[model samples]
Target: MGFPRWSRLGSDLRRAPGRVRARVTTARGRGGPSRRRSRTSHADPPRGGSCRPGRVGSRPHLRRHPRGHRGGHLLSTARSGDSGGECPLHRAAGARDISRCATSPPRHREAGGVRSLVRQPSRAFVSVRRFIAFGVAIVVIFSTLTARLYDLEIVRGDYYHQLSEQNRIVRLPVPAERGGIVDRNGYVLARNIPGFAISVIPVDLSRTREDELSQRLAALLDLPSDAIGDVIRAQRIRNPYEPVRISKTPVPREIALVVTERAELFPGVRVDPESIRFYVDGTLYAPVIGYTGPITEQELAKLKDSGYLPDDDVGRTGIEDVYEQFLRGTYGWREIERDAAQREIKTLALQRATVGNTVSLTIDDRLQKLLDAELRKGVDEDKFTQAVGVAINPQNGEILAMVSIPGYDNNMFARGISTAELAALNADDRHPLVNKAIGDRYPAGSTFKMVTGLSALSAGTATRDTVVNVSASSFSVSGTTFYDWRAHGSLDFVHGFAHSSDIYFYTLAAGTPFAPNVHGVGPDAIAKYARMLGFGAPTGIDLPGEDGGIMPDPQWKIATFDEPWTIGNTYQEAIGQGFVAVTPLQLLNAYASVANGGTLWQPHLLKQVTDAAGKTLPIPQWTSQKLDMTQENLRLIREAARRVVTIGHAYMPNLKIPIAGKTGTAEFGASAGKDSAGRNKLGFHNWFVSFVPQADNTDPTAQIAMAIFTYDSSKSLCELCLNPAVGMTQRILEQYLGPNK
Candidate 1:
């Protein structure tokens, strides 16, 4: 058999309910709860005038049609003599009809018998039957319905009561204001401004006036006409009464326009107060301080479980992100009573918001501004991509100045920038958002030698008098050659470091036939020493995103590149190349350690914290650890660093303050050998790192230690205050330690 068509089967099932009822009733007991024979089947209305069950007025006409001639219609014509004009109704039912008419009892004769009965039985019997049937139906239905009602009202009362309560009361999320951000001196960095957002109470609006209301709102809010329609359409899919934002964070002009002209057209439109971010000082501390914007979708998802909302502003970078918890105050809310239409009637309960605490940094505004001015001057003269400058007090490891060039105005984020402005900022090649002092890592150049000299001395690798001959400026190891800026004939550690003799350090690193372990003392030793001086890790400064510069080892080489560490790699790194890298801040810290007599102090950028009431809060002070070094070894390294500034090396002169320093001309890209003047046009990192007034009987401690890292892609030294040891040292001593103090 062919597969059954479900459409035809469905129709047949719908039409056959009478048969179904008869079958089901017989299968069950008729004596118990007699089921009503409800007509479930539906069929198309019969052709012409068929006797439908509805009206008794049309029944006589239907009865006459079966009697043929009485209605001039044929019932059956098979036995009729006239084939063409024969009446089928007459042939099929005329005889039976005549017999029924002849033998059937008359209604009048029955009525006549009814009158002879005592007490008028006809009227009494009819009334009695109807009354008994009606009473039985009423009792059965009422009893069944009453029992069901009892079950629902009492047994399942708690379950239904909770459901009803949920339907009546809606728990809404209250938007909390974000905390304010401030500088060390209580200057505001980021803040909230009260603003308004337009919303729609969709269910309150009439469907007939929806189009007109949408158009009027579009004009008032400066929104696309379709936007209003879309909001209404979306609400229709969810709860129509729930409030949905039409224009989030609408401008003041937009809000005013709506209130003025289109007030009557927008019954559902309302202004909701919101917060906007602000930044007072624009480019002064842009990179170090960072900015804040709207929370992104991806960030929102990550913070959704933490109870963040769509409008909440979070820290995007720098200290804003670093101390987000402390900088972002707690959010508060209110319990409000709302009408049936979800319009807030009044606030039943309110909670005052707590603002975030202000942060005080070790950075001095005066010193920072001066440092920025100096860096800007350097950048303009050199025409470099970027520049950074850092100054610190060696006695306490306090960062006095930190400056980065090519700063940006944070005010762009204050007013909630459009998509185009944000894209332009991010797309700039100069990377205005970058914090160069801590974020960028460059080779510390020759300045890193102080760490090598100190670490090797402490590690028993090389001594102050460990002499190595240098016939030429360049040195060779394992057939690979490395060269210095100038040649130095026969020199000790002091002379070698003062002249930056690459061959001298290379010879000690290559390990002469005299000392087998001496050659093991190449870049690996330098890197080890570098880490010991806090070169390869964060200086523990209270800044965000401090790049721990790379210091490669044998394990690092194998893990990162699946290659063996080579002697040439070590030799290149010994000269602060190959895989060696360090931030300017790290270089300064290393020299400061040597200046403070082998003490490694953690660089601190925060001096103290306080409450709004002016009560001082307990905070950790600066601390340091001393390296185990003999006084003789420290004296040798100290003299070597000091001579670089005072003695005639690279035509640089000694300072009036008797400062000890080193000038490193590291060949980085293609121009490492040239001076800071950019004459070679390749890239070389010029470094001058030093300490003041070598420790002695008169002044056992150096007051300040400073390092200058200036990169010249053009290879011109004149633009960088070439050999700035004398000038930089004089300026620092004059400001901090001179008679002006």
Candidate 2:
């Protein structure tokens, strides 16, 4: 397009110099009306006066209304014929006057009014949209949750029902009572006595009374004041509800005192029955029987790992320790109903606990008592530092009676001993806690000669008629002089053992038959026979701490002594010295071998185990092995041992029945002390092992074998410890085994 004539004229005007300028402005007042600004209006209206608009924009076709006379103005928003501006007009204005209104004064009210109008609907729309969205989301979520609830409660009902039941029903364990221990004749050795103990439920104590209650309890129970305060403080810090044991195994007087004073002194104190272990025979078999005490913190830690509870009791030693599982019974539980506050309302369900089994030992009560009295006398007479005496049935390896010197009152341990009392017991030089029967390992002395003889006979290296001519009381081996206690003339094997001639055995250990590998039997052979006779190994006795006595061999010598096995070592072992050591029980078991005609039976204390209903459980069976040896050799050895007691010495004549025994006096350390007779007295261990014969081939009802040792600081060649064994043996045999064979 071509430029209009007006536009061309305007351009020429702009180009002309000194052209007159014209300005125009339009102003609207809120949404009400617009104001007009004109060059003519400035002259027409005086200052501070109002001027009405004739037209608002171009392309208006309305007439202007007369001023005053209640006339209304009409405004129209329209697209301009020449531009895109809104047209405004009065009710009387014409289109010719529309252009004059375009340049008007700005209306501040109109601008603010338009903004307010525009923002109102937008705010309402936003609010509505958000509300709808939130409603839809909430509905969807509600539907999903309801469907899941239906599925869990109804669709998979059984599975969830079981889960709910499990949450509601709680099962707890009920500890079993430990089995009672009794003697062979049905005398109660250990039994449980019922008693009441004071306990405090921490939660039941009111906060205001807590400290006061602790002080009162401390005074009443004779507990440490600090300890009582500590317990109360700890309970408050922790759960504040768990029960604390104030005192255990309280006596009847204490119980009665507590009952009378509990209401005034404490709010939580309660008396509950608790089982306490009792030793009926007191100190009779304290060492052998042992005792039990409360589970310790360290022991509790181990037991917890093994699934044991705090209330469980455990056997500490002896037979009780060996049979802990059988003696400690199974645990069961009852489901109890409680409120939200844990107040036990009632028993919702009940399950009873199974009681422990009762144990019957193989120990004889009467015989054990007899042996204890006599052995105690022997211990008293010598004023020995320590000693042990054990008597066993040789045929079956049943322990008849075992006694340890410096015996203790097991009742002290029954309820648990005080620190001062325990220290007092241990303070004495003589140990009372030691179970010497199975725990003490000492040199068997000449008592081991029978084992040597058996091994020689079994190896086919020597016979009963074997003889060794001795020129003197002493013999030299590898440049070391070994002497016999008694000086004797040329003696056969029988005379050699009867007189205990060291020269005869020393020659036998070094003679032609043994010269090939002198030292009668080397460490290897001696150890083999020792093991065969249940030495150097546990005897399988139902007791804890039964040591496997030392049976020195070449390997042991290298391992322990770091020394090589030599002929001297073999000779030392041949005469039961060197590194060879055996417990009193081991020696007794070995004698039983000879008494039972070469058969070795497993020695046991647990005779049988039974259930609560008296139905017997399966008895533990053991296999017996017979040592391969000729009866003729055994008979000759028996005769030689018998001669030591009968025709050989006056001590033998006093034995009522046909008793065979050998005394041992092995020297240890130095001989410094003297007996009543001023002579070089030697330190010695005394032993006498035997079995009474009932028939030609069978053992007596009770084949008695006694091994007793008296620690003599004096080096008296004449052994005095054997006196009691001889006296006790004679009395027992006469009373039980009748007269001579």
Candidate 3:
């Protein structure tokens, strides 16, 4: 009861923070040895008893000391059960019987001097496992941190480094300069001029101040504020990152200076150097060269992968459209380092732009001018609003000059045509926007008679010696009568061809009751010869939008009108009067075949091409085909055509240089209203096509063949009508052809 159990006491004290040793000394008493003996204390070691605190040596055997104490023997001052006697060690262990005490101690020890508490396995700890857990936790935490550092710095370093650079680096596009167009004689037809364009960044302009920005830009551009706002709004909806081009064309220098000099006033506006297209003699050569315009949203969607941007300009028509792939050069870019605010600090790398290829046309500017002037003269003198003229070399079908009156200026389109200007062009009655040379179709008139005449020659139905009874003004077939312009009396085939006798050709096309029994060449034979000489189809010229004019046969007529083909239709088609149409280029090439020993070549405008480095490039291969007519028949046709200019209605035999030609007058307006006299009130289309010989007619392919067509002339086919088309073409040929050649 005086001390703790020996096993637990030793462990508990040794695990404490400090070593403990306890001692007790006898005190000096007044009564010598008796007092000293009474103070001495000894008892057996206690079992099944609690130690008492702070009452040392009252009733005890021996007490263990706690940690951090030295020179001490512990004791208790508690009274024993049923015994109140005082005892130095349980009051009776010193002399009396200790059976009165409830518990007895195991072994007793007496300490005369100081005693120390030093138990075995001395290690300082209340709980050693908790400290071990803390040490392991520290080691694990440090190991995890080291492994994470290895993964970050070594495994994925390059990838994150590239990402860091990309956040500060950007690439900007560099547009290439468009190419120039020249004529065969090196005359500049189209080129590019340095200019500036205005652009606006939608994100740069504050949403609340967008209206003010639009108003300011409208004042400078002379455009509606609402229109400018619409453009900005559209760009913001599409993409907030890209800049939108404010001006579709080049901005004036004065306006560009205002945007660049006063940057604060225009927050989103920027000036960029943009090349503007310049076309020399735009009006004169509009149909041949064509124009360009800015790319639309729909076009950009299709061409985004092809390096085309929203601000790029694209070819619209003619050669510009036909050769667009070559003319549109590849774009370049500049890699630049930028700051956090996205302002470029320095150029990191750059790729230079490659300019577009240079294009040279086969057109002779001088001849083109001549053809244009001559057609203008015809329009004024003949009182017509529309006309077409085309001249080509008979040898290889290279077009020398082509003109379509009521033509528009290509420069206006290149400069961004306004809504009103474009509407006016589309609304004009004469059609200034249409290219009549190749896009429009008309009756070949008597110009088509050569096709029928050749068909009859090949069929052997009518020969040069064959005669037709053209004394009658009209020829009757299938109860439907077809009339000629007038009766030429009785005539031979060659003489009938020279005078353009419709009755003579009709008799050969569909047999009539004539002398020597002229046989009829069926409708298929006529169509065959028509197609053979480049009629009834497009010539596949280098220009865009060519019409394959109508060539009606029995099958075609049944498919179109759902009616049976009558012989009367054959008679009408024989003279190029009904269901027979051709483009101006197709008509000219038809005659070119006859004059050039029966070779009908494909027409082309591009002569050659060169790149930016002055190296020649391969040109596109244009399709060509030769006519299927014999040389003997070609000679016969040439002689008869020469007679048309010498002794027929063309009538131009006085010149030293020789030429051959034919004149035609085609009737139209079957659907027109009646006149004051209650007549059907038909309109006539006048035409004259010719070919010029060199010094001699021996070199036939070296000649130049031309065609002139005037639309809706009142006096084009009247009594004693001079045929203004013939006059215009004859003048052009006289000036264009030389005697020495």
Error of 2 at 498 (Å): 1.9
Clashes of each: 21, 22, 16
Preferred candidate (TM-score higher): 2 or 3: 3
lDDT of 2 by residue, 388-438 (tens): 777777777777777887778877766656567899988976667778788
lDDT for each of the candidates? 0.61, 0.64, 0.75
Tens-place lDDT per residue, model 3, 1-741, is 233344543453354334334222122223331111112233311232222222333544455333222345454544332232233334424423232222222122221111222333324352576789898999999999988877777888787778778868988888998888888888999888877888888878888888999999887776688988999999889865557878787865676898889999898887988888889898998988899888889999998999998788998998788888878887889999977655679999999888899899889888888889978876887567688989898888889888999899998887667677888999998888778989998887887889899998988887888888777777565577777768788888778988888888878888776554877898999999898887778898988899999998999999999999888888879888789988989989988878888777889898889998899999877666666667777888888888887788778756655778788888876434566678676777888888887744534754578888888754324532577787777677767665432
Model 1 stretches astray by more than 4 angstroms? 1-271, 296-307, 395-397, 461-471, 475-479, 511-520, 540-544, 558-567, 604-607, 611-625, 630-639, 648-661, 670-681, 690-708, 711-713, 716-741
Question: Using Cα atoms with residue i matched to residue i, what is each candidate's TM-score against the true structure?
Answer: 0.68, 0.71, 0.76
lDDT of 2 at 141: 100
Question: Which sequence of candidate numbers ranks them by TM-score, best first?
Answer: 3, 2, 1
Expressed as tens digits, the lDDT of each residue in 365-436 for candidate 1 is: 655666666556666875655666677777778776676766677766645455667788789876677777
> Candidate 2: global Cα-lDDT?
0.64
RMSD of each: 13.6, 10.9, 12.1
